[model samples]
Target: MRRLLFWLLLFALPSTQAAEELRLTNGEWAPYLGAQLPHHGIASRIVAEAFALEGIEVRWEFHPWARSLLLAERGDRHGSAVWLSSPHRKETFFVSDPILDSTYYLFHRKDRPLHWESIEDLAGLRLGATTGYDYGEPFQRAEAQQSLQIRRLGSDLLGFRQLLAGRLDAFPMDKVVGFDLLHEQFSSAERARLSFHPRPLRSDSLHLLLSRRIPQNADYMLRFNAGLARLRESGKVSQYLLEAQRPLSLGR
Candidate 1:
């Protein structure tokens, strides 16, 4: 009886330790979260360090955003980063405090002579959006009800092409991504023809989304928030941004 009890305790230890480990799912979208060679990106680095602070190990899997979200939604994965929190997602997962702030800008041709003060201002305009891209509650709701002419494109680059060809009147995209795409994919003349609205459609906080299925996620959430606070206090967050932005600035 004593020997059997000791063997049972030994087996339980491994399972307990495994439960504390975290598995993160991400997609390859550059300048935010991507599956680049050495490491994913700055967000992944921040996530890894935050988990490390709490003695948690993180592993990542790269997939399409839709599939990645589905895995996390079903509790098949531990969590995901750089996701916008919305009422739609609150039921399936818990979101950490905002890890970053993102701005959604409307891009149009330089010759279009259109300006948008707000999302409502764009009503009836043919706007393009990337499939599976979440802007915010108001915009998403508007898009769903067909109040706006939102065309779903396969990729951001495609949307840019459509806009230039007059197929799409305008497209909504992140400022960082918009600049990157313009610099990388557009010719000098083409880049000059593209312009963005002076104001962003909206700005929102981005959070690290954790699966509720993982019993340890509550504790992990606390650690992530605490770690982020520490980074902010130490000014590390600003430093990280400066480093990440260096390459983008050099090209200009």
Candidate 2:
């Protein structure tokens, strides 16, 4: 009777548990996702607020882009933010709804003008690309076929440095990120010397990626998507982005 009473009392007790904490990987992509920016930039801000709406707390760890993906895929972290989705990533991770949009542009020196209607036009020209970055399937195919001369650098900063040094003819980078980095890292004269082609290379959305190695992340992605939708409906996502883009002293 006592044992039966104990079981009844246990079942009657509240089943509610503490909200789970999620560890998410991030990288330094300013005005979007960065460790130094206020609230770790707009994308990270949106991620936190969205998860907060669902009663999940997030802890962020910043690393290089490649390492960030590795950690997430291994489930060392719950997920990573702001990655362009690809087939391999889709197979390995549960991709969330688009958190931000990215537009790619071919950046080059103003004095060294370049015009191209297609990938073939870029043959024999020196181009800089970042390691572990996929511009697109078309660009990839061209590089693989040896139709385009490309140099892979470790980061966008290095690519820009190569362009500035006249060692690279062109570098493809996100329009927003290119401008943001120029403003933050270069002098006024340096910024003036560089420009991006008016024609965009491509446009893609950035998404949060949760590892498939963790079974709970499948459910997390659903909750994240739902919360993201709410944030979008509330118009806070746009609001956050506009606020982040505002110019400030020190460019933090």
Best by TM-score: 2
Q: List the residue pairs that clash in candidate 2.
A: none
RMSD of each candidate? 5.6, 4.6
| Structural similarity to truth (TM-score) of each candidate | 0.83, 0.87
lDDT of 2 by residue, 1-252 (tens): 999999999999998887789999999988898998989988999999999999899999999888998999999999999898989899999999999888888999989999998888889899999988888878989989988999999889999888999999999998777878878788778877877777777889999999999999999999999999999999999898777552422122
Q: Candidate 1 — which residues are off by over 4 angstroms? A: 1-20, 246-252
Model 1 weakest 10-residue run by lDDT: 243-252
Q: List the lowest-lDDT window of 10 residues for candidate 2.
A: 243-252
Query: Tens digit of lDDT per residue, candidate 1, span 122-142?
Result: 898999999878777778999
Residue 232 in candidate 2 has what lDDT?
93
